[model samples]
Target: MTLPQALQYLGTAVFAVSAVLAAGRKGLDLLGVLVIALITATGGGTVRDLLLDRTPFWFTDTGYVVTILLSGCATVVLLRWRHPSERVLQIADALGLALFSISGARIAEAAGLPGLIVVVLATITGTFGGVLRDVMCNDIPLLLRPGTIYGTAVIAGATLYVLLQSVGVPRDTAAYAGMVVIAGLRLAAIARNISLPALTIRDTDAD
Candidate 1:
């Protein structure tokens, strides 16, 4: 399989694992778990495809569905025996974000899109699935949450990918570099409790 295809499968599996963990926290049943997993794994790609006027990746390939089902079921079975920590869920999410972000940027670049649009689509493809998962879980989407470094990490990764290519870096190497930058920044933020400063607004009516 091509590297992009492999990254898509791996990213889907990682997102499925995170979905299982998130759904487990909410006491979802097996069916609900599967549903959440499906959404978390494919939601971003679906949106990306719709915007690009292309068929959704899962629609074109059965492998995507099979990977999600197998990964979700296995995670469910394993975690049924032992519950996972929230940190583990976050780590899986970070990995998925990295993989999908880089792959998405590459896809846009291959389509001859400009750098800015590539980054925008990459961020959407990386974070939108998690957004859908959070919405279904009745939590504020991570990307929309104040002080979260999630979208920033994705944008940085995608931008780095574009810059590397501009400097004539090899495609595969640039892709891996982008993934490392994304996952590293995210995981570091988690480990160090790093966060963006929250936005504040003051009322002017009184003045």
Candidate 2:
């Protein structure tokens, strides 16, 4: 399989694991776990496709569905039997976010989308699943979190990808570089607890 195709599967599986964890934390049943897994794995891509006027990859390809199902079931079974490392979750989150973001921007780039739109799509593809997952678990989404590098990391990588390509880098090379930047930045953020400053408005006194 092509690198991008492989990345797609990897990202889906990793994100499915994250979803299973969230669902398990909420005391969801097996069926509920599967539902969350499937949606969190593909929800971002589904939105990207709809906005791009293309059929969602999971709809056109049975492999995507099968991958998500197997990932969800295996994650549920394994975690039920034994505890997993938080590092696994962190690594997966970083990789999945990077791959999905890069792939989303690449798709838009192929369609001749503007740079700003490409960046937006990349951020959405990277973070929308986390948004859905958080909302499903009745928690605020990570994207909405105060002082987080999550979305910013994705945006930085995507912007770099566009800039590199504009400067004559090969598309595949640029994409790989972008993915690496994203994963590196995300992992670093997790490891270092790096965060952007939160935005706030000065409080006003009421009469």
Q: List per-prediction Cα lDDT, in the order shown.
A: 0.89, 0.89
Give candidate 2 regions above 4 Å deviation: 205-207
Q: TM-score for every candidate vs. truth?
A: 0.90, 0.94
Residue pairs with colliding backbones in model 2 are none
Q: Per-residue alpha-carbon lDDT of model 2 for 1-207, expressed as tens digits?
A: 987688789889999988998889899999999989888998888889989999887977898889989989898789868868998789988999999999999899888999999999999888888888888889999898976789989999999999999899998899999999999998999899999888888889785
| lDDT, candidate 2, at 128 | 88
Residue 146, candidate 1: Cα error in Å is: 2.7
For residues 131-165, could you state the per-residue lDDT of candidate 1 as single tens digits? 99999999999898876789999999899999998
Model 1 quality (TM-score): 0.90
For every candidate in turn, the CA RMSD to the true structure comes to 2.3, 1.7
The best candidate by lDDT is: 2
